[model samples]
Target chain A: MMQQTSDKKWFDELVVELRLRQVHGSAIGDTVASARELLRDTGQPAEEAFGPARDYAAALEFPAAPGHDWVRQALWPSLLGLLAFLLFNQAVTAWTQQELLLVSPAQLALLATPVVLVALLPLYLDAVVRRLWVGIAIAAICAVAGVLSAVVAPTQPSDAWLAIDPSPWLIGTALVMVVLSVRNTVRSSRAADDDEIIDPLSGTTAGTGAGARILVHVTNWLFPVLALAMLGLALALR
Target chain B: MSTSTPDVRATDGVDWPSDWLRATLGFLALRALSGGPSYGYAIISELERHGFGAIKGGTLYPLLTRYEAAGLLTTEWRAGDGGPGRKYFALTEQGRAELTRLSADWRRFVASSVHYLDPERPEKEISP
Candidate 1:
């Protein structure tokens, strides 16, 4: 049981290390299967047989896909989705109150905190993945910034830096979120876009079960779902 | 322990320095594959059987992977009988040529080192 747990952890670390190195899914799957084959033959623990997972991953040095490919494919879409979600959250409250959405410079900076943090993720992604505390700290910072942004929101239009009608912003942001979710849903359903681990010998992919599909859909639609919940909360408060 | 067994000597419980293994394990591994296609454990076993200390999977797989990437080796996956499939690695023609060259060079280097260290050699007597 202990050995299995440790081996599981080792495999998890290996996956993270390989992903950080920008190795493609097919190659990662092959490397994993090969390692498992040796472990089964020798009946040795993964770490014992294959040094540190990070070191092993680095040593393989598989030909990675272009570095910025992920940024273009995944990150930009996510950042855009996040921007839309934040705008929806801000607009929903004002729409519910039938007032213009007012924003102060302080509130804007505080609101930008999460977006900036997420934008800078590529820089500290290694630290975030390797250390639990770093991930937790980042989450906490984003959460606090969100709450402080709300607290610093201007009550009167005269004190605000920008005052805009909430109706268009609310509808526009919601549409953006839904459109992006649809795009993601379509992209994810395509077999070529899926990166499930594959069996090298049989050439069959693993981890494409119903649960995985559902999880992928949920992730794709996450921003819209959260925006809807915020709309509900705002309506209730009103 | 058996006279019938070829005198393929083990390292006799003495651990070879890591530097020595790191320096030679690459070509040694290619030479092991020269016999035919083999998997990770098989390659390690062949090396251990031939008197090299047990090579860890960590050491062997990375070297093989790099060789595969360099086009010196090509890999195939064969299904095991009632078990998981195995990834087999076979040397390419380039790999075979590299192995032959490295083997010849290694043999000459070893022979020169042995001659230099030989107690009966006159060169040893004149050494400062």
Candidate 2:
């Protein structure tokens, strides 16, 4: 435990330095890589970098930003789960055309409330706050689902697999549960050891022209928007 | 082989530093640099901002010198925005590639770990 704490402290300290903009932008890669190299060279077991694992998941929720590191890894899966719920809700509503059976806009907003709130909050808050936010979000989903299920139960048609309108609340809750479960698994993995660093000795770049670099940056920002627009067009045309 | 005494292996079961530490250090440095370029002091300060205050001058200075020597990082001497001239360090392409590789590995590690720890569905398990 002591060793783990120290490792976390060590990594945390490095992050602090980086956040202050002290490290030269060009050397950032090497500084991080070298520190990691030193640790391995010194024979310490690498800590796990768990947060980046969920980057794909989070990208589902928000536009991707470079170098946010763990935020994407941690919140992404949750965001994806929420997105699935939203999509599923839309599908069910479009299919059933029942306002009560599906989630109302208010409920959808409520469902998103916890995650967006947690996300928008300043990072300076306590870790405990983050944990609680996650927990409360899960609980809220379940509660909303339960209420929806009860309300929808009596309205089911005889041939329907579900007796009532499929409650958007219930579906959303289930989705939240799925996301939370994933997050728990992620959290347990490698024990959130703050000590873990990524690869070192990997500082090579393609060194394209300045124009190319700007183009790359601009394209990164635009790719998601273009994709989203395309998706919207497809949905509208469908 | 010259004149130094031969090193002996430790009989005690204490674990020495491993490659993980070195990789972690390098990853952190790269992440820091992604923000902007800086000299030693600026890098140190940046580390502090990221919640890594324990990295003092003793550990940081030698590491910077070594990185410069390896050409993984390049330094240009520049007058300070406010004060004296300082050596600025930036990532070479080789260094940036290293960061990408490390980041991917880190993500993989996290995913595998999560897979092991919570393999079951949430509805299946109830916590007290």
Please name the candidate that would achieve the greatest lDDT relative to the true structure.
Answer: 1
The Cα error of candidate 1 at residue A59, in Å, is 1.3
lDDT by residue (tens digit), candidate 1, A206-237: 67889988999999999999999999999999
TM-score (all chains, Cα) for each model: 0.95, 0.29
Q: lDDT for model 1, please.
A: 0.89
Q: Enumerate the candidates' DockQ scores in order.
A: 0.84, 0.02
Fraction of true contacts retained by every candidate, in order, equals 0.94, 0.00
Residue-wise lDDT of candidate 2 within A1-238, one digit each (tens)?
Answer: 7756866665554544443322333444444444443343333522332122122122112222354555566556545554554445434443344433433444445546555655653353333332578656656765675455434433334423323344554456455645555554455344233323322233233224577556644433342333345346545655
Predicted model with the maximum DockQ: 1
The lDDT per prediction is 0.89, 0.49
- Per-residue alpha-carbon lDDT of model 1 for B1-128, expressed as tens digits? 11123777755454789999998999988978877888889888778877788899999988998898899999999988998889999999999899889989999999999988888899746669
Top TM-score prediction, candidate number: 1
Q: What is the lDDT of residue B70 in candidate 1?
A: 90
